[model samples]
Target: MGIHWKIKSFEALSTHELYDIMKLRSTIFVVEQNCVYLDLDGKDKVALHLYGEFEGKIVAYSRLFKPGISFENASIGRVVVDANYRERKWGHDLMREAIAGIKTHFGESKITIGAQLYLKKFYESHGFVQTSEMYLEDDIPHIEMKRESC
Candidate 1:
């Protein structure tokens, strides 16, 4: 068996599931990145959570947003793969699922994201184009990217 994918809204997430999501986000976004920002931005309530689970642990995760929620276009954020799982192609898998989920749930093909500068090419491979200059967010360099439906 391989990783399992799940897409759920805030209201549909169980307490443990929510906790696991938060834990993974913090592990990467806060500790690994060493950037301190409000992780709970009060937007998770409206976004769709996409994650991959393996062996009972959340390994890869991203959040999908409908238009007008996080950005004017459909968006995917908080993309992460457990550091140990990076070699397994889970990151690509997560983004593929996220793009599909965005289309499935929002009926939109235009998607945007605030991606870490280091991962620009990774996103570009998935059809995202850099739309903004390099900028600092919580002391880490980031770039805004957009993907339009082909």
Candidate 2:
């Protein structure tokens, strides 16, 4: 089956949708990555959520932030694709949808993200250029990247 995409603000998310989102995030960011940091950082209330569903499950997910939330420009973060679906290259699809979501929802062309160091090329393919020196977040090497409005 093909992926189904959805974008919703915090209030628009149904209880089940919210649960699945948090569960997917925890599965990847906390358990899979072995990173222990607060996932609920009080940002969701103001951010836009983008997710892709497959077979009634959330297989891809990301969050979009308006300017001044995570960066001076609009931003995309919490990018994740279900481990079961990663081999299918849904990460790229997720990003493409996320870029569009940022442009459509926020009407902002410039987007910034603090991406994991290893995935620099993945983000680069989406037009993100490294804007800051490598740094560590949650003990994971990360770099700030930016994509100007196109």
TM-score of 2: 0.98
Model 1 residue 46 CA deviation in Å: 0.4
Whole-model alpha-carbon lDDT for candidate 1: 0.94
Error of 1 at 20 (Å): 0.5
lDDT of 1 by residue, 1-150 (tens): 899999999999999999999999999999998888899999899989999999999999999999988789999999999999999989999999999999999899999899999999999999999999999988889999999982
The residue pairs found clashing in candidate 2 are: none
Residue-level lDDT of model 2, residues 1-150, one tens digit each, is 899999999999999999999999999999999999999999999999999999999889999999999999999999999999999999999999999999998899999999999999999999999999999999999999999964
Q: After superposition, how far is residue 124 of candidate 2 from its true place, in Å?
A: 0.4
Q: Quantify all predictions' global Cα lDDT against the true fold.
A: 0.94, 0.95
My TM-score estimates for the predictions, one after another, are 0.97, 0.98
lDDT of 2: 0.95
